[model samples]
Target chain A: MTHKRVLSLTLNGKNRQDLVPDNMLLVEYLREVTGNTGTKQGCDGGECGACTVLIDGEPHLSCITLAATVEGRKIETIESLAVNGRMSALQRAFHEKLGTQCGYCTPGMIMASEALLRTEKKPSKDTIRTALGGNICRCTGYVKIIEAVETAAEEVAS
Target chain B: MTEVLPEFRVVRPATAQEAAAAHRDNEGARYLAGGTDLIPNVRRGIGDPDLLIDLGGIADLKKIEVGANGARIGAGVTLAHLAKNAQIAAAYPAVITAAKSIAGPGHRAAGTVGGNVCLDTRCVFYNQSQWWRESNNFCLKYKGDTCHVAPKSTYCHAAYSGDLAPVLLVMGAQVEVTGPEGSRTIALPDLYGEDGQNYLALKRGEFVTAVLLPKDVLPTVYEKMRVRGAIDFPLAGVAVALRRDGDKIGDLKVAVTGTNSRPFIVEGIEELVGGPLSDEVLDKIGDLVQKQVSPMRTTLVAPFGRRRIAAALARRQASALFAG
Candidate 1:
């Protein structure tokens, strides 16, 4: 028997209440229940960081996290990174630097970078690499992705 | 495509005793921690537990207490906390290093020390998708009757690949466990068994609550050999804790993981006591590791190749620790 509960969480700065299954993963709830397809599931499970999201401002694998466990927590996905429909600094940086090639891993990679830039206004290249270490981009070979994050950090700092 | 999780009721327990009671009340109930390891296995149709007792609500399990008697790390403390905690970084460099080396940034943010310590044995044949396993006709660790890794043998050869177990084992840590019966403490080595299928020796309904470190911390180093620097489990991991007495080694302990069913301390380490930090002693340490670790065809890497790498890691870590 599947148990269901009304999960109340802050999603993308908006309070949301959804009757989700206890076993439902956060990624599933975001994409299916809330119609937020910004998060991607790259691997069969947690092998890839394509489903990364920020839970309370920390990058966590939403694919492995149950939706019910995150009750009342602030969840930020790639969908939440814009201000009044304008692309955030990190998003603009990715676009300008050509950080994405196929764009499959961009949402998660950008969200992971978003978390890092929030805390660290100016992070070293090594720090940026470590922050996005979980994120895998087969395209771009991470060169442009690193440059995008560096440009975003400089823009945010300035 | 995203894999669908099996249907199960999640029960949030506030305390360790309550969690144990919940597990006892529900048959085939599993304690859910960070879910980094368990969720993936569940998605792969490994063990289908009907109930999941969520331990995230237990605040006590998420504590780290450092006092005169050393530190007691609660089971639910996240790996990211361990990696960034100033106290842990200052007092236990090896622990922090191991925590940082686990998986990746997202994984470390969600994964916990207890979950890593109790991680299931992994094999190339066992950790695949359900369809993949079905096509291979299963293995000895799960539903299959025959051991695919050792086909003729009756035992499963899946190797334990947790990074923290070796570091903790080398530092002489103890684990505090709680179960349906009661609570007790045991040395870290006693927590594991040799059988790959049933490696963890915890009794039914019992789970580790906390790990207690000794008052006197030693200089230690952890070395891991894997295909990638991030998001890959170690092929062969080694941890060495040594105290230098002038130019000689004193009270040295070496533990190895990822090559056996159970992470274990290499025997005959006492023989190296008082020995100079020379190439001869380092070779002996490597030889001892190669002799003790029993690696099978559990991963893409060959068993002998993993054994050699494990020995090399042991020797390299021991030499580095001795030098410092």
Candidate 2:
């Protein structure tokens, strides 16, 4: 028997609906059905934050969340963080500060940092580290990522 | 045998009753909440259920409310949600502290308290991949009768590693589980048995719906010991509840986790209620707790390291209790 369920979700800024299997993870649905493959999946388990996305502007692991569970909720992926072909100040700082190398952890890292910045415009270094704790970057050793967030805070404040 | 991973149908029910009915209908089916624990087991093929009933959509389980009676924490409330909740932070700071230390923020957001409390007692042998288990000839925790950790023993030696269990035990929390039969409240302490494999005493097909924490017990603190700061399960954790009458200790409850198959309430601490909480008295209590816990080399760290931390956690929790 097919166990398909209807999910109504707001992805980025667009409202979308799809019928998917009951067990389909949100990350898979975004990659397969919605054709948004930018959100990478490192560890299907919640350990690596490669699947991190913003649920109601808060950082959440998309890989662990069920597609059906996000019904009627707003979700923001890395694709939405930028505005109209212009990188957000955070994105600019990430590039300038060399926040990424292999780029696998970029989406999740950007989403987590964006979530943190939304609430705290000028967060401390510790707050930025805690926000990005779930995201694992094997390259660059997170020095640049942390600096990028710090620079982003200053850029936004200025 | 072919390496094809078994696939299953997933059912999402809107209500608890509907979920229970689904559970009753499906053979070899398990209820899925956060999937922080279940998915990993499924990935390892240790959990081969024919059906997975996703309860994340169930309305009743997502609630977090406090009334005149007490706080009713819904089973689906994520650890991150509980950790950040203002009321929970104020009323039971120990629980918040415990929840915060459970995993990193993303896991905390995805991992529910219900999943954490109902976490399957784990042994290193049982938690390993099927291929790994085959190499070692299996263990008592899985299908085999031989306990790899303690070969002569009849039971499994999986450690109870949940960060929330000890805190809830010390706070005198009760779990309300809804099953095919009906609903029942098991005292947090009674919910877990010492046997690692068959750790939970809750009836078959029963799912924990809510946890009831009683009001106005005493000031409490949860101390968890781990190698790293976050994500790692407690090597050893302690929850201490203390009440002081004037200068003398009125009551004390010490609960220990991660060192045994189930969390244990340290007995004989009641005797220390009337005495002062001196360094000597705390040390004596620590010794008593050290005697009660029997840690194993089942999880991330060594057994001796776990045992040593159990006593240290007890002392730290006791100090926190007495300080406030």
Candidate 3:
């Protein structure tokens, strides 16, 4: 096997370094090595978005991402959605609107929504639904998730 | 869990030369890009190469520039970037629309245009997990001798699954590939072999670097039919690029996706040029397209349905692109 390489990353605003095999997926590295279990591995394939994370402020599927590729890159996992123990406005809205059911896909859904809101700030319901379309939610039918994003937009607006 | 899965060396090469050298150094090595296609195939235990040369760290492969002669899209440029690129949106709107229709936001953010073009030919039988393949006694693509899609046929019949390929082909794009020797550019249509298994003509250890669009070509239209509006590979996609001289069709290029082995260019539709694009002419052209395209049942949609949709979408896009 090829020797493992040290990958330095700025994860959720903290500088971290870990030795990762080239085969180690970013999602696995995040959950297993960094102990950031918030990045769930749903499909182990690119089909599911449960392992979504933000790389350079853009949402990406972590399951398909090689951990070695993110060296020196800024990564934002679901854990960073909160600041100083206070949930981000989107998280509060997700809870307030009861947006989650099984909670498996929330992290990815929230990350995708966060990316969308960071750009649009106020998106239509259809746009929110389209934005989160890649992250499948077998639970809750996603009505409340769209509602949660809309509610969060309103909260941020007010 | 009983047996140890084979673990191979992993190499992360930061530059083109390093990546090429790493690939040449190992016998069972494969370049890894966005992995929207490769990672899933590996997890499914299909063609699991021993060494994965991660090309994602190579910075030079991620540039997207619009020059005097159309656009140059780097292989590592993500689908999300292509979908949102202003130059692509304005100059090559068909490609932008196709890229936007690829997957949801997250996967799009990770799926690169190069990965999409080099997507493994997909068949329902071929895409299953190893255990599932063991149960079914694998097909012509990976294991057994017989074709799964067509038992009587001699070769694999996996569907061409990329959404952007047809659009780019219609735009008359050329792809550049780099390897140990050097880089070479070829028309995208010339990049695929006729057979599904040997679809790509890329050399071993060679990586697709970029795609170059023609300068000041005709406007294009892309129409795709799938089960869902988004996050679904095309059941059948038709891309038509045409130049209009007043009301006559001047130059026409039609490429169809999700059919057969490689995306086929409809060079057969040149008979109607210089003639009035009347309803009857369009109908004849669609009929010719239907006769030429040989879509099979491997696609998610019905084979006949895909053929008919291909004809209809071709007619629609032709008229849409050519009509003033």
Which regions in candidate 1 have their CA more than 4 angstroms from the true location? none
**Which candidate tops DockQ?**
1
Comparison by TM-score, 1 against 3, better one: 1
Note the residue pairs that clash in candidate 3: A2-B9
Residue ranges of candidate 3 with Cα displaced over 4 Å: A1-3, B1-6
> Which should have the higher TM-score, number 1 or number 2?
1
| Order of models, best DockQ first | 1, 3, 2
Per-residue lDDT, model 3, residue A158, is: 89
Ranking of all candidate structures by their TM-score, best first: 1, 3, 2
Candidate 3 lDDT for residue A81:
85
Give lDDT: candidate 3, residue B132.
Answer: 85
> Model 3 TM-score?
0.95
Off by over 4 Å in 2: A1-6, B1-5
Model 2 lDDT per residue over B188-295, tens place = 988999899889997778999999998765788888877766666778888888888777888899998888999888888888889888989988988898889998
**lDDT for residue B77 in candidate 3, whole number 0-100:** 92
lDDT of 3 by residue, A12-86 (tens): 999998887766779879998989998888877767688889999998988877777778899999999897999
Q: Lowest-scoring 10 consecutive residues by lDDT in candidate 2 chain B?
A: B1-10
DockQ of predicted candidate 2: 0.44
